[model samples]
Target: MPRKRPGRVRTKNTNRREALKLSTMAPEDYNVRPGEVKSIACPNCRTWRRIMGETVLKIREHCISDKVADGEKHVTCPGSNQVVIIDIDVSHWQARQNRLLRDAMPQENRRAARQFYKPLPAPAAPVARIHAGVTLETARRAYLAHVEECVRCGTGQHCTRGGALAHRYVLVRKEELARRKAHKQSAPAARKALWDQRGGATVETANNQCRPRLDGAVSEYRGPQVPSKPLRVIA
Candidate 1:
């Protein structure tokens, strides 16, 4: 596409109230970097306005108050249509701006532009927590239920969550089997202990039921009785 035609340059006859030198103004307020359209902030209104015309750039005419259209008094900005002379070195101004920007940036972000960036590793899949009372039946039901609801699992495959549930089910099943095996192994010892306790009670009951048949001495082995007072030694 053809480039835009350069507008008229500043002629000696182009009357203006005052002229603004680019060097005298703040570097930030005016931009005249090479290859970019020139723009500057209006001194009175402080709004950025495009520089019209080639060779001799003029700030686009604008009002002092933007609210002038809304039944407000119209006052033209003093900087409007003001002639801007490019007196400063554009390259030097750009370099200083670059330095200032680099200094203002956060310390962590300053990096070599050409360096290879290692792509971040993909995020890990989320899984449900196994609470205190998770059991084999409950785990299996959960896995099956997830498989039924998930669209991805309908094709005889597991999604991330479904896979996690299936894994939990298998783990719970293994744990339950191991627990059952342990309980089976311990049953004989528990039974023997219970039998011993019952046997002792039965023997005590039988002894209580039977009274001594011998007369006169009543030769039952009773424990000695406590004395009423302490024995006194003869002095």
Candidate 2:
């Protein structure tokens, strides 16, 4: 077999040396200065770029599969094709560092990265039970009425108390009104039925009275009446 190329052997030696150097390096050896935007080469595309502070820290804290926790300046390229864990303290000087890094980046890239991390507003307190015995229906109606009234007055939008009161009133009144109306309607129908039955019975009794007396009408009529007028001869 032909002798192994000297160049290939040398390249292999160089790679092995570099790997040894990296393995021997401690986490503290890569301390990043505050306000410095460290550029890292992408392992996949070999492109160089910088990352955000929050992203860098988060990755540094949780990216490693090994059990050893190395608090360092960790960063991954935007494409996530490469990750670097460096020993650095950039947390306290993040703002200044990010500003410089942002300035170095293209205007479009900088704008894309610029975002506000606004916290979401807290939820509102639940509506309190202002009035007892208020049914849901009544409460809902009251709430609607209050809204309507507010719209008319132009001051209702700001009236928290008014809305609550309205809801309560609607709930109670609606139930009561419904009950009263139902009673009124049903009561009349019942009374009318009773009156009709009574009238029917009275009419039946009157008809019975006109019939031949029960005690005297045992036999059929068998009588001839005397002539009131002389008979006319019309042969």
| Top model number, TM-score | 1
Best by lDDT: 1
Write down the lDDT that model 1 would get.
0.78
After superposition, which runs of candidate 2 have C-alpha atoms over 4 Å from their true positions?
1-154, 193-200, 203-235
Deviation (Å) of 81 in candidate 2: 99
Per residue, candidate 1 scores C-alpha lDDT tens digits across 143-232 of: 878888899997888877877788788888888899999999999999889878889678778879856565544334652364447999
For each candidate in turn, the TM-score is 0.43, 0.21
Candidate 2 lDDT tens digits, 1-235 = 5532211111111111111121233423333454454444333334443432332221111222222356554442233422344443456445555666778888766554468889999886545345666676767666666667675435645376565566566667877899989999999899879878879678768878756555643334543354447989999
Q: In candidate 1, which residue pairs get closer than 3 Å at backbone N, Cα or C atoms, i.e. clash? A: none
Query: What's the alpha carbon RMSD for model 1?
Result: 15.2
**How high a TM-score does candidate 1 get?**
0.43
